[model samples]
Target: MRTIGADSPQGIPSSLNTVDIFMSHEGLLLEYEQSLTRHLPSPTDPKGERKWYNTGAHFLWIGDRTRQPDGAHVEYMRGIENPIGVKVGPTTKPEDLPELLNRIDPKKEIGKITLITRYGAGNVEKYLPAHIEAVKESGHVVVWVCDPMHGNAKVAPSGVRTRHFADIITELSKTLRIHKDNGRKLNGVHFELTGDRVTECIGGSMELSDEDLSTNYQTYCDPRLNYEQSLDVAFLIAKYYANEREDMERNVFRL
Candidate 1:
């Protein structure tokens, strides 16, 4: 749950690193602040400036890996409330993407790579592992966005509602632990959070409620938070691992 800070480089603290270094490409957010791109990159990279992910200590990754370029799509990924990568999936044939991947090669020439998979990008498990494993299965890292909010109202053929947000969370948490026990440092979590408090989404009440979860299909605006709400969750995540670091010593991860 790493936050895009106000003072840190690109508004992120140098010391804190999430499993995936997200690069949001939300040019439509300019509707709220016209000057954001003066500091951030546009969908077109209007300024053609270099990206900070190029040298960030953590692995470089992107999110919202969809092919849609509409305002709603971009806002979902690039909005301040949703500041993750906004690159489309392959087949759109965007030249800039491949170049970015090359620049952020996690292998560091060690023959291993850090590969990313988007939650809604589809068939993530197969395509992702195959890609990175092809590079170097021995040490490859695979990090997913694992949003706290997903699914919708309609029940799937599996007889379970799509709004089972906790299911994925629990699944990913177990995945992390397995990675930890197996001593895989390449696996990590990527969360999209802001500084705002959200009363809707997963849970209702002042906290969250089951009835509040998205139904049928999830719209782009299903989940959100206020500034204080976002910060509390972010700090909590940071502290949880910080405490684990104390108890587990070197085995616990903080980045």
Candidate 2:
């Protein structure tokens, strides 16, 4: 639980050394920003060109609440060169996705748009398949990412906002399977996690209970995976992808 100064050379938490190692081994890093358009440099350029909002993050995502097609957030993000993502919740209509795609990635550019789905575990089986199909039918090429944390959040009996590690894993597994069935790839996962050993979320390798939350439940908004829990999740995700790779190899050999 050692705190690293914000001004530290790498700017990542000291406890996140494992994450650094994982990313180094994986050969790529993907970072997400919420409500990215709001923080963009104001349109003060004389030619009306936006001053690039360079937060050094790899990707930016509009929040679920602000993903309206005609909204300023979408309008502003449409012109940016960086890859953009839109949070799609269970309530999001599959029909509306085409217009969003037209607005954001009109050319059907591959990897330019990412639709991050946050459909809760209860609703994902019902909602996600259609959305993926609709996007595919439209002939759009966008990445699919899962935000399992937000969708599976719950309030524990202790009154703390928390997510079950089981729920997170379940939703992510479902997401991966559904995307594969639909002939699409679930490229990434979005999580709110910290490198600190705080007892926020329940039931990781540590088997944390509701009572454990009060010991160091230090989150301002939603609960996040603690250092160990984050590492556990990383390992689980790695295993999933590794198994997928092995399956692909076997299929290729059989072919």
Candidate 3:
């Protein structure tokens, strides 16, 4: 695996000998999450007040389908101290963002919330800028993450659910560019990928086609990038960010 944040020309801090890999999952099942919830001593509070945290995963996110303002998911998520993520899709109203932010993060703590954008390749150009603006205007501290997988899924000719690599790349590239142009840093990315040789997603350096999918199609739900394709995406993101760093160095005023 290519190590990031250490021994690179980009000057990432060498604070640790090993890279930390965090596990994040969609907080879809409320009952399971509730079952794993634990009361832990508050890290920030000096008064010794305990905080509720879902210990099943290091990070948890509310799905787009369950993020209603006054809904149970939102209510449950607001009570937890674990860093929370909320899915923001094409249908997410820009005006509703502040209210949602206020509901989840009333204190507006930095890094307390993350907004994961999954607008498909076609809808990103139409929707993202406004969401960015809305979040900025609200003055709520939030990390922006791009999830390019879920929205680009399509059924192939063989009737197997799959996502096109080209579409995924397009969405990711566009999200990066859009965030840079809008004067915001896209803090991270989310992808459905695996370290196996499953041909769930088509079109990469291997030129896997729709017919090739049936050879090793293996996902019970949405498709994922195979080992080779996952590397392709990793390299693509690294290259884009490297170029961005160069651009920032060349023009300090580029934002």
> lDDT of each prediction vs. the true structure?
0.38, 0.81, 0.91
Q: What is the lDDT of residue 149 in candidate 3?
A: 95
Misplaced by over 4 Å in model 2 are: 1-58
lDDT of candidate 2 over 1-255, digit per residue (tens): 335433435565454454532120110222332233234544555665554452544566778888889987787677666678888998789999999999988988888888889988777889999999889888998888899988888999978799999999888988899998888888888898999999999999999999999999999998999999999999999998899899999999998
Cα-based TM-score, every candidate? 0.39, 0.77, 0.89
The 10-residue segment with the lowest total lDDT in model 3: 1-10
RMSD from true fold, candidate 1: 11.7
* Cα RMSD to the true fold for all candidates: 11.7, 8.5, 5.6
Worst 10 residues of 2 by lDDT: 21-30
Rank list by lDDT: 3, 2, 1
**Candidate 1 local lDDT, residue 114:** 30
**For residues 1-255, could you state the per-residue lDDT of candidate 3 as single tens digits?**
145634644555555645877878888889999999999988789998898989988889989889889999999999999899999998899999999999999999999999999999999999999999999999997999999998999989989999999999999999998998999899999988999999999999989999899999888998999999999999999998899788879898765
Q: Which candidate is the best by TM-score?
A: 3
Instruction: Mark the regions of model 1 whose C-alpha exceeds 4 Å error after superposition.
Output: 1-23, 26-114, 117-172, 186-189, 210-222, 225-232, 250-255
